[model samples]
Target chain A: MNKEVLKALERDARTTPEQIATQTGISMEEVEKTIEKAERDRVIVKYKTIVNWERLGEEQVQALIEVKIQPQRNVGFDAIAERIYRFPEVRSVYLVSGTYDLAVFVVGKTMQEAAAFVWQKLATLESVQGTVTHFLLKRYKEDGEILEGGGEKGRRQPLTL
Target chain B: MSPRPGLNSKRARSLISKRVEGISPSGIRKFFDILSTMEGAISLGVGEPDFVTPWHVSEAGIYSIEKGYTMYTSNKGLLELRQELTRYLYTRYGVEYDPETELLVTVGVSEGLDLAMRSIINPKDEVLSPDPTYVSYGPCTVLAEGVFIPIPTTVENDFKVKAADIEKRITPRTKAILLGYPNNPTGAVMERNELAEVAEVARRHDLLVVSDEIYDRLVYGVKHTCFASLPEMKERTVLLGGFSKAYAMTGWRVGYAAARHEIIEAMTKVHQYTMLCAPIVAQMAATEALRAGDAVVKEMVADYDRRRRVMLKGLNDIGLACFEPKGAFYCFPSVKVTGLSSEEFAEQLLVEEKVAVVPGSAFGECGEGYVRCCYATALSDIEEALRRMGRFVERHS
Candidate 1:
């Protein structure tokens, strides 16, 4: 798995191949090969920047929709999950155990748009027994990055005893 | 108004010791005074880590206080802490010290340096050390009434204090050789064989060796050779190590010294009268650190390695000549290309670029053409600082 190279990149995606070599105590060529393999094998799905959207004043409506569905003879929950995840508004989908068969993450520009996805596309599906929607109000942390340590981060006093 | 209170109080200027008065003020002080008023400035001046003490270590300290273990520990420190240090030294350095007699916990490696010099140095005795070494060594030597003989090392030799350079400067009264590795300003580390040569010299000269290994855990792509572990050196070497750089526990003010029973005893005697002991809470935390925080230190070291590579490459790419530094968090890049003194480079960079670096000459005269930039800062800030420095160097050049 070349876990060291993966860890170096996972901690900081912007880390260069040369830096990955230094951090992992490996050669630059090895780091490049491992990362290339990871990308090709889908172990590393994508490299994307985590922007502070709130700073740009572009607020998003994100909701987690817990869905229960009847299991089909041939494909249990997998068919309904694919059906729910294929929609443009649905950001992520996971088949969870316990109270719900699948937990869907949906995002939209407005609450109405987010709610309508549950009502129109998700709830109306066949064998879609029930659904509950919880809207995300605020994100204090995301993707292992603290969102609040940024705002009002007063720089330390320049010189002191 | 008659003489203003602090501004015009001048009666006691001569009362200061002539020894202290002879010492020059830190060259970086002026730059720091200038930096204080500037807003949004990035500082590469600090010598310590940007990371806080690991939460697990702090949790252990809190847990100790919760159990009412906050009394003044033994003058030497808690027995358990000393035992942990014994195990650590044995396991890491392949050297052993008796927990009961040979190890003494002190306030910090700073205090260890002070106590070691004070205990062994007689009045007017000369101590051989590196020219551009840690800033504390010279002052501590003076405070102990010892004559400090600076053996200069240049960038050509990777800033290491060579045995021949040190041996040539030794005199009849030369009592000891003091050095810090994974050194502070230059980030230079002496290899095992290189230091073994120095150890041979010490054996020939019959001098003590005081090794401050505060940055022992911060070396990148290099192994630190503990002086006391080398052949026939342990009996004459006083090893100083601490949790400050390793576990990011600087504010805790805890460190230890291990040596032959005599040297440890003498330093402990000085410690008893002057500093008493390291704080019990900190001692407790250190004990926990030695036991459980190896993984945390490794993680921090890896993070620093990534930042070090970036800073080195970025600075070198921008035309600042930095010989590869294999240890510590600093990168001492030559700023002589700008036709400016080290102090002037640091000052102008602060004023124009709003990035603060310490002039390397603050360490010694041989450091004149260099500036010490600490990479303990954030990676994004390092990149940004490099960009500003690139423009500054371009403008000046």
Candidate 2:
């Protein structure tokens, strides 16, 4: 499964093939081949940096927009799901097993921009019964990273205890 | 100013046990003293996870407190907790242990190590362990009045203590072999077949084996075979494990020791007198850790695996010859390329670049030309440390 090369790239896409070989104890040629194949197959979709936008004063406005849609004549949620996900503002779309039909994460630069996209584009779509938008007020965590708690810092610098 | 109260007090020194006095102080202490005084020094020396106990486990502790379950637990710790450990050990290693008499919840694997040493080691009995093991093993053995014998290992053989070497060192007085795999400074692990060889030696010699598997779950590219799971070895092996490394529960002070009933009984007697019990609240949290913390542990290990890749590649790329460490969060890179002793390299690197790494000599004499750099830090910090180390190495060269 070339787990070593895939894991290395998943951690940091910037890691060179030589580094992956050294890290995984694999030959450089093997690492290069696995990575090339993975890239060609689209198994490695993207390499991204986790940005703390708040520190840069570019706090993004994010909202979870839950949608309830009527089943179509034949295609059901997939037809409307494809249409909603096609929008540039939609970050993620999920057919949740819950009170809602589809849950989508929408991001914009400002609250007004997010509301405009919802009111202008989403509400007017065919078979989109209604949408409940919840604006994110804070982020204590993101993408499995804790954004808060600098950690109650009174620990003495340990001498290998 | 007048001299401090115990600055030169001979009597005060004598008041400490002779065994404790006999043990040498840590060689890394002087460097750490300077590192502590220096401001803005980034340390890659601490051998611990950067993550705190997962929120769900912490919440369970708080919930137990809210329910007022604040009372002294049994000396062997909570039955519920021990039973959970039983199930866990069984599932992970296929080893069955009786919950009531064969398991003792301890105050971290540190306590379990001490208890195992004290319970079995009579005065002047010898215990064989690898050199450059966790710092506490030798001291713990000495504290129990047993002689600590270091079986030296080099970067060769992937730093695994050879079974032949261990057999050669055994004498009539040798009572036990102490091992920690997925090891600390070197991050060495033994393959199952290799461990079975050691188990064969122990069986032949009729020696007790205290195996510390605290870093059992931290392995990459290898499976950690529980020593007690070996054929007919359950009765002879004291399996020590804990939540500190795997569950990021260092502050909770919860761990376990499982063996035959005789050993657990002896250990519980010492544990009862000394520790009373592992904190009850922490026990509740540990119960929750066993029940729901598997996914969290997997996530944390995934994070460590990525860090391992970066740290190993970065050190080797910087011209420090480091073998790929398959377990734990440390990268032990040889600093011989700079022609500087590990101690000198650690000190100068800290002073010049404001980055701190542990001199490997602090682990053992055989660890002299290497440094232990932990990767359980922010990736940015690790990268920055590597850059500074590269500059330091360049200047030295």
Give stretches of model 2 more than 4 Å off.
A1-161, B1-11
Predicted complex 2: DockQ: 0.28
Q: What 10-residue stretch in candidate 1 chain B is worst by lDDT?
A: B5-14
Candidate 2 CAPRI category: acceptable
Candidate 1: stretches off by over 4 Å: A1-9, A14-37, A49-140, A149-161, B1-8
Q: Quote the lDDT for A79 in model 1.
A: 82
Give the winner by lDDT.
Answer: 2
Instruction: Residues A21-55, candidate 1: write the lDDT tens digits.
Output: 75456788988999999999999998889887888
lDDT of 1 by residue, B1-397 (tens): 7977663345466777798888877666787888887887889888778887888898999999999988898989999999999999999999999999999999999999999999999999999889788888898898899999888999999999999999999899999999889888999999999999999999999999999999999998789899999999999999999998899888899999999999889998999998888899999999999989489999899888888988888889898999989998999999989999998898899999999998888888888999899998788899899999999999999
Q: Specify the highest-DockQ model's number.
A: 2
lDDT of 2 by residue, B210-279 (tens): 9999999999978989999999999999999999999988888999999999999999999999999999
